[model samples]
Structures are given as C-alpha cells and as structure tokens.
Target: MFEYQNNNYENRNQMYDYYQMPETGGPACNRPSGPKKTGKAGKLVKKIGAITLSAALFGSVAAGSFQAVNTLIGPTETSDNTAATENTSASLLKAAAIPGAASEKGSLDVSDIAETVMPSIVSITNKSVQEIQNYFSMFGYGGQTIPQETESRGSGIIIGKNDTELLIVTNNHVIENADTLSAGFIDNQVYEANVKGTDPANDLAVIAVPLESISADTMSQIAVASIGDSDSLKVGEQVVAIGNALGYGQSVTTGIVSATNRTMGSNTQVVNTSADGSALPTYIQTDAAINPGNSGGALVNMKGEVIGINSAKMASTEVEGMGYAIPMSRVSDIIETLMNETTRTKVSADQKSSIGISGLTVNESVNSIYGIPSGVYVASVTPGSGADKAGIKKGYVITGFDGKTITQIQELTELLQYYPAGETVEITVKIPATGGTYTEKTLSVTLGAAENSNNTQTESGQQEDKNNSIY
Candidate 1:
C-alpha cells in the first residue's frame, strides 16, 4: 500500500483552471427548431464524399461485462491543415505583445461588425436521457437510475469548415454528457452534431455537424468568424457580446473592457498552469451583459473580430458590472490541441467501470487540524460503480491506487493512466466508523470504464437549474 507522506510549501497559489460552469436549472422546454437562416459560408455547394473518423470502437460485449468506449485519438505530431482563419488568430494573439503590431485601432461600427459575425453564431441544444434513482435507491433502498429527458440551450461560433463538416467551438459543459446534440442556425434549421474533441477541464470543446444538414445555398450564407488579437486590447475598449439570451433568440450586449488579468475563486476547475507556476487564468474583464446561455459565445472588438470567449460573471446581490472572458491568446493553443483530435479510445458511459466516488482535494489546513491525509476525500459514490459494488461509500479516503502512493487528485489521475475499464485492481482506502476511529482496508475492485466514472459528476453538475447564470 502507498503511504501518505508529509511535506510543506508556503504561499503556493492554487490556480484552478478558469471555466465558467453554465447553469442548467429552469423549466424544461423544447428548443425552437427555427428556420435555417443561411449565412455567407453555409450556402449550398457541391456534395462532397463523406469522411469517417472513428476511434477505438468497441465490438460486441459478453454477458455481465462492460467495456469503456473509445479513448481519444490524436496526432503524435501536428496536422498541416493551416487555413487563413487559423493564421489570423495566431497573428492577432501576437499583436498584443509586439509594440508596433495592432489591428487597426479605434472605434468600429458595431452594426457592421455584428452583421458580419452574426452568421457564425449558432444556438446549441442538448437532449439527454438521464437515469433518476427513486427513493429506495437513495438510502441504499431499491432505487434504480431511471431514464429522464432534459434539454438545455447554449451557443457556439463557427470557427472553420472543411469539405464535409462545419467545425464549431463552444463550452464543453454545453455538450457534455449529452445523448444528443443539435445546432440551430439563424435560418430555421437544426442538424445533428457529433463531438470532435472536448477538454472539460478547460471548458472548451469542438463539435462537427455535417454539411449535408444544410442546403448548398445555406452553406454559402454562413461565415467563419475571424479570431482577433486579444493581447492588443486596452482597458475601456469597446466590445460586443451576442448570444441566445435566456434561451430566447439571439440578443446583443455592448460594453467596454473593464479589467485585464483577473481571477476568481470557484469550485474545482481543471486548468493548466503557466511555466512560472501561476494557477490563475487570464481574462479580459468586461461589462458586457453576458447572461445565461452565453457561456460559449463571442466577445469581439470594434473590428468584429473575436478576441475572447465570454465565460463568467459576478453574480450576487452586492456585485454588478463584472464579467470575464477567456483571452483568445490563451485559448489558441487549447483550441488547436482540440482540433487536432482524431479518435477516442475510451468507452462511453454505460459500458465503462469506475471507482464510483466523487471527491475534493484536501488542503493543508484540513490535514494539519483533523489529521486527515492529503488526498481525494470522497464526497459521494455512484450506486452502480465498481467502488460501490466493492462497498465503498462516501467519507472514505482513498490514499493509494495499486502500489503507487498518492496524496493529491493529480496523482490519482496519473496512476489511473495505467488501469483501464474491465480491469481489476487493489485500492487502499481509509474508512471510519461512527466512534471516529479509522481502519485501513484493501479492496479488490474491478475498474469500471472511464466514461462511466464521469457520469455521476456530470449528472450532479446538471442536477439543478438554479445557479444557471453566466459562469
């Protein structure tokens, strides 16, 4: 068994990856299948042959055993598909740091910019079949997770289009864990979408919808939004925000850049750290009216170029005029990384095995005061997960996986890299009885699929329609 070790550091700032978790709580309603509003680029063209990108597709499974869906496939090296929009985004990000480099500065005609970019914007609707556990299932009673339907609204921007598919970018939360995804265009038309790649921790994802979904004329009408240089932005600069406000039709909000390089404390976010070791995310703070369903929308400059992605806002009785957007400079690499994705080796939710517990990373104070080890402190468990089947429950502290010592969530994730679905392994957990004493136990757990491991967390995150505001 791996043992917990004690080490100390001072003033280490924990930078949670910055992502505004969009709220989903509200009355469920059918998303309007509006008429397809054609854009300059989405107009019909010659029908191209289909392109099939398949990952680790699981074959037939035997009785009583589950396999994880395909794991993500990516290139060992970068693809050479350099389009103009991609180059423009790179140039814009550079302009911020180069003294003489800047997009034509000055106030721009908001109307002209809005019209040019609006065609790239789209409304996203997610349809899901969730399993709801009845009362008996709640307390270890005979509760089975039943299928329930839920729908949510958000927005996306058309970034690039290939011969066969139109690639769009949006927040991962909008399409995450959904059974079906659809994109509604300005013209009263909606088409099925498939996930090309997603980075949930970064709150970024790319989805592909077939070109055949729209007529050649409609395809010609759609335009690809030009990514602008966020680094070139000055505080107090004018910007425009557009989104499917309140699940209604597209609405526009105008404001100035409020601040730059801002940070906020929130629930655990999965983000990358800078080489210098900062945990904070960069943002272009603005006063734009970024409301619900705007999480993945655009924040553009006067030139009508996208410089940032509208993400979060300060919501409180006491706070106002504060909203945050991920700077385009910081996101260029992330978006490119996602676009390069080609396959998924992991299984989907239903077929995978998992330890079944959700947890929080314990900090030093808790460890020093309560003697609780610094590791993943279990908060809950999925009823049907491998950890649950092994009798694991909430409040158990997982200290080790296999033979590796783990003291943090990152370590556990790294250790998990070695194990896969349908595989059995030994895990060390600390369980305490009612009297406040602890016992260490080793359990033989057959690991569930990875996709299944994320289901409970996704379901819990989507449970309430409350907290459904921007970020």
Candidate 2:
C-alpha cells in the first residue's frame, strides 16, 4: 500500500533473484526379446522370470533411474565367461550411479540472486476508476450509470538512486490511462507514485516515488544495480529474470540467453497509423518464464546486473518458453532524461506541428542500384490537412525535419514529439517524380488535434487547449 503524490522526494535504496527432463521411470523401456530355454530332464522347468527381471533392470537404466544389484552366480568353466560377468557387473554399477552423479553437481543459488535483486523489482498497479453519474428517465424511472473503471498491474525496475529519490523504469502501457499509480516494494512497503516521463512509441516509461517514509537504516541497505552493456551479451550466455510474477509478489527465474537483436512489433502507435508504428530497437530474447505481471521487470546477466527490461511473452499453445525484453542500451537515454527532469512534460497538442511518417525509408538496394533516396517518404495526405493545405505534396520524400536529417521512421517520430500541434514549421522534401527536384516548403497550416479511433480526444490530447490550438 504505497502512497505517492506529484511532489516530495528524498533518497532511498533497495536491492533484491525452466526446463523439463524426460521421465526417468516409465513404460518407455526398450529391451531385447528372446525365448526361455527348457531343461532336458522330464521335470525341467522354464526360467522366464530371470529374463523378465533382466529386461526390467535394463529399462530402468535407460529411463535414468538405475539401481545397483549384487548377484552371485556359479563360476563358468571358461575364463572368458568370468570376464564377461565382471564387465556386466561394472556396467550395472555405472548405470545405477546416474542419479547420484547428478546430485553431486551443484546448481546456482537462485534464492540468493532473488534476494539481491528483489529490492529493485516493483509491483505496479494502475487504476482508472471513474466517477458515477445518475440520470432520471423521461417516464420518471430512476437509473444509474456506473462509469467503467480500468486498472492494470505490472512490474518495474528500480534504476534511480536511493539517497535522494527512488526512480523506477517500466513499460509505458503499465501506467498509460492510469488515473492512480502505486508501487509495492519487496519489503512490503507500498508507495504512491507519479509518472515522471513516458515514451509510448518506445513502450517505456519512467516513474518516481517519494522516500519520505523510508527508514534511515533500511535506506542504506538499498543497492543500485549495475547496468550492463546489452551489446556485449552473446547468445547462449546464462541469464536470470526477476519480476513480480502474475502480481504474486517478487519472483525470479533463470535461463540462457536464447537470442539477441530480436525485433518486436511496436505495441505503441504513432499518428494512429500502423504504417508508422515504431518498435523498440534490438530486443533481448530469453527462454526464462515470464508471465503477465513480469512486464517491465529485469533480465539480468550472470553478474546479477540488468541488461534488459522484460516486456512481453509469446503466446502460443505450441511454444512454452519464449519471452522478450527491451534492451537496456536503448533505454538508458530515456531514463537519464527522466531523472534530470522532474515533471513529465510534452509539447502541447495544440502547439504541436509536423505529422510523423514512417516505414518509407529506401533500402540499400533501392538507394545504390535504383538511385532511390534513403529517407522517410510520405505515403499519403489527409484531405484539408496541414501538410496538404500547405502545398506539401503527398508522396514527397522527407530529407530533413527541423534541421535534423531523417533516415528512419523512428527519427521522424522522435522529432515530432519535440514540437506541439498547431506549431508550423518549414520542411525539406526531395520530390522524385518532380524532375529530380528538392524543394523547401514553409507551411503555416495549424496542426489538427489528435483523436482516437472512437473519435474522442486521447487522454493526453484532452490536456491541450483547443481554442488557441488546432481544432
């Protein structure tokens, strides 16, 4: 039950850590079959029991549950017979030692790792409870309208210092649409939190909470986790995962570095266009078991340092061990910005200009062979829109925006975030079909306010001033 507000800060510190083996004993034994021999005497009896026992023992060994057996047999007349029996006895002994051999090997202490990393893992709950409204019907019948309240829960990583204030890193969706935000520490201390900054296009968010109530002694116990270079991580390296699994408190899981430089589709949107959707650059994929509440948790290396923030788990009936995390290399810049800035500020919607376009960058082949420019190309134009009204032609290739050269779709999206809607600016575009013309266009068209698919203003958009800004 952490309580948080917009203001108040101090220093605090915190610290905190799946494969299936085949069944060892089952009906999967493969053994040779043979008939039992009968004695020559009239009263001779067949010995099928000995063959059955031997088959069962062989099956147990193959299934990984071998047991040692000592048997006394009559000495054979030939020396070769004795040698064969000795070899068979030695083989049985080795088979029976399989389980013990495994037991002798030591495994990593996951609990110790969990204890070291648990302080940095936080459980986040985002709630959007709406106020109820009541209305009377025309027929004098009373009715109640219960506004729906939405809440989401996820995990976060502690990246900020503990002495002056506590800062957390999590996915933007964890706090997106949340009217109330709170975080619970592994020590059972809950604190109200505030959104410091968020980049939905990257699916990353920075949050902060006051450390006023944190005890002085326990504060020193807080340890700042070291950030490792994700670039250095290699495939097949051992890694660990720590998070609030399924909202059931702090949990730790381990696996190897399943892969690196994995690409994931952007859960965040840009300009309401899937064409312009931005994804996190170079994800770190792991086989660690990450669940619903594990989003925003830490994917740590063997040194117990964080390399990535666990974000998503693959959903499939056939796949049971795939999870994805945002690489820390890409998140360091965003986290640093949030720490330096107190409030999460953005260019007001009305004051923003320049619609961002994505996915039109020319490939190397197109640039080298076909002589196509390698920059973001405008796909289409909105009717009566700012760019359209300003004579900025559709299908024009944008070379630069606001003095920044654009190479990828992310570059355009990032630049647009710096300015608010309704703010007009000049743009440089290369018109390929216009006789190889490169034109500079100055457009003063007022930017239009953003609306969701439901035709309602976005939560962030609602904060804009419609009168002075765009309509």
Candidate 3:
C-alpha cells in the first residue's frame, strides 16, 4: 500500500488493454433541418457597428486628454525614455540573478526531443494466458479453471543492435509470462520479439528482434537512443517522457525532475538496494504524466538523451502528477549483461525440464522466523531423480541456478522454460552446518523430463505434497 500527499494511495503499474478493435455501431450525425434566419445575423452586425462608433468616440476623448496633459507637462520625452530604459535594465539584471530564469534553455522546446527520441521508443504487446477461477463453484458444483488470453501494452527503448538482432530494453514485468511478443516501431511496422535475458531483482529485461525480420524502411527509420548519465541529473532539471500512453501511439509528456534518489520503501516493484547501502533501488521521481502504457518508456533529458526508464507511478483519487523511473546509470551494467546473453525461445510444455523437488519460498518472514538463509527450502526430492542423484537432500535450501540468483520457486520455474530436459547445469544449495549456520555448495545436475519431476516422499516417511512445486 502506497500513501501520497497525506492520503493513502497505491503504487499501480498495471498494463492497459492493447489492440482493442473500434466499435462501428453508434448514433448517426444529424444535420439541421433548415438554415437559420438572418434576423440574428442582422442584429449582431448592427451591434458591432454601434460598438465601433462608441470605440471611435472614446479614442477621440482619450487623444484630447493626452494632448492636454502633454501641453501641461511641457515635453518630457527624454525623462520617460530614461525611466523605461532603467526599468528594463533592472528587470534584466533580476532575471540574470536567478538560475534558469527566462533564458534560452529555461524555456525548452520539447518538440525537438520528441522528434529525436520517438524513433527509439517502441510499443510492445504481450500475449499471455491467465487463469480465471470459476464462480459457479460457490453453488456446490465443481469449479472449472479457465485459461483466458490477455493482451497488454508497454513501451521499450532501442538500446543497440548486433549483426543478427536488434536489442530493446524494457521492464521485466512487461514481458513476464508472455507467450508471444511484438514490437510496433515508429514506422508503424510490427516485428516479433523474444526475451534475451531478464533480471527480476531490478525489474528489467532485454528483448531481441531479428534484424532480417524487419523491413528495410523500418530499419532505416528506427534508431538507438543516446544514453545520458542519470547521476548528473539535478532536481528541477527539465525532462521529457516519450511512450505509448494508454495503448495509443507514441506521445510525449514534459516535466522537471521533482526529486532524485527516491526510494519507495516496501513497494513490490522495487525490491533491491544499492550494494554500498547508500540508497534502495532508487527512482527518478517526476511529475510527468506516465500512464498505464508508459511503463518501460524513456525519460529523456533536454539534449534528446535517455536518462531514465519509466517504470512505476503513484495513483490516488486525491493525488496527481507523481511518476517514477529507474535511473539508467544504476542499471547500465545489468542491461549490458542481459544484452549479451544467449537469446532463447520458450520451450514447449512437453520438452520443458524440471529438477525433481518440491520446495517452499524462504521469504523475509520465513527467514526471520526459522533463522535460515533466504532461498527455496526443499521439502522433498523425488527418488532416483536428477536432484536426488546430484546429492540434493531434503531440508537444504537451493540458492542459485547456473550462476543466476534464485530466491523463489516461481523464479526457478520461469527459468526452466528455456532449458530443456537432459541439459546439465550448476545448482547451488546451502547446506545446514554447525552452529545453525549454512554452507554454500555448488553441484552439477542433469535435468530430468517433466514427467518424472513429481516429489515422492521425505526420508521421515511423511507424505509430501506438491504445493509451490517447480521445475
């Protein structure tokens, strides 16, 4: 729960429904039955004439008064001119004294930034399946689970391109659990995209589109955005946000940096903190109107350089004009790592691999209550399975997989979608040691087929359930 302006508000980052078709049925336009009478027009013309005559009479009186005053004052042109010059000079000095006051850069023209950055921003569409629970079960009938296809829209920035693929960086939640993805470029052309890699801790991901799939015209039109140093950003510095707002086409919004190094504590979207303990996964707080579809868009500086990536915004009935973006400098290295990762396509359900284990997520509460390390606590291991053969025992906590950090079962499950069965990978686990401490050990495990990934039982002869089980 997020609060704003002394009022309770939630930090909302949900996606807007994209690709909704327009409805054709509506009321038809009705034209006037007949032309209006000339009576009103004639009266309006007569009123204008009378007003003009009155204006001429007032002007004559004002001129006569001016002439009388001039004769009485006896020619004071030099004094009036001198006073005007002094006043103008004083105003100029005052303006110069203040920072960013009435100067060339003070009043920015965002049109130029929009023009340069629009080509780098793209509209992303995610097609995924969501489970819908049945309402009829309340009447004693068995509930049926239904899978519904959903389409969501987000924005991405073109970071760079290799010989084979064009890489775009976006928020991880935008493409999470996506069955298919497509990017709409500035040239109005859409291309298929696949996730290259993701860092869920930072809520960032890099997606790649094949260069050969894009048309030459679109390739010529799209460009990589210039990256700017977010560390150099100052409060009240003017910035522009460009994105596909509300699932519409590319649009631009301008605002100043309300504050820097904003840490929205306990917000689910931002969970990590700096290694030096200086700040939490900090955000660039701005007053720009970042709508639902603006997630993963670019927060650009006046020089048409990208300084931050639009991620989340605070929403409330009593609040307005507060949005947040992830600073670019903080995640530059992570983005580069994701870009260089091997691009993988989602494996089919039948071919997906699984490590034979049922585990519980060791979240903050569990870690605190049990005095155990934060990771997945293995409840049971299937007999003769890959995990069992690899010396994985019950009561051990799995911490890392193939050099990637894992803290929950869902993260492991999502990662298994790319690695098929029989693929050998390293699995790191924390073994319970003396003094109630844990020792880290890495083991090579060959993944088994999904059919044999069910947990059997623990050594204590207790029946193990498949709650929160993952492959």
lDDT of each: 0.66, 0.62, 0.79
lDDT of 3 by residue, 1-471 (tens): 121111224434333332323334553223357775369886886687779668766766766676676665545665765775676555435322322323333232476667767899999999989887777866768877789999999999999999899999999888888889999999999999999998776778899999999999999999888888899999878888999898998999888889999877554343122111123488899988788889899998766678999988875666677889999999999999999998988888788888888788787777777888877889878777789899999899998988677777777888888888999999999999988999999999999988666434343254566354545
Quote model 1's TM-score.
Answer: 0.54
Ranking by TM-score: 3, 1, 2
Query: Lowest-lDDT window of 10 residues in candidate 2?
Result: 65-74
Better of 1 and 3 by TM-score: 3
Residue 142 miss distance in model 1 (angstroms): 7.2
Q: Judged by lDDT against the true structure, how good is candidate 2? A: 0.62
* lDDT rank order: 3, 1, 2
Clashes of each: 56, 29, 0
Per-residue lDDT, model 1, residue 202, is 54
In Å, residue 460's CA in model 1 sits off its true spot by: 28
**How does each model score on TM-score?**
0.54, 0.50, 0.73
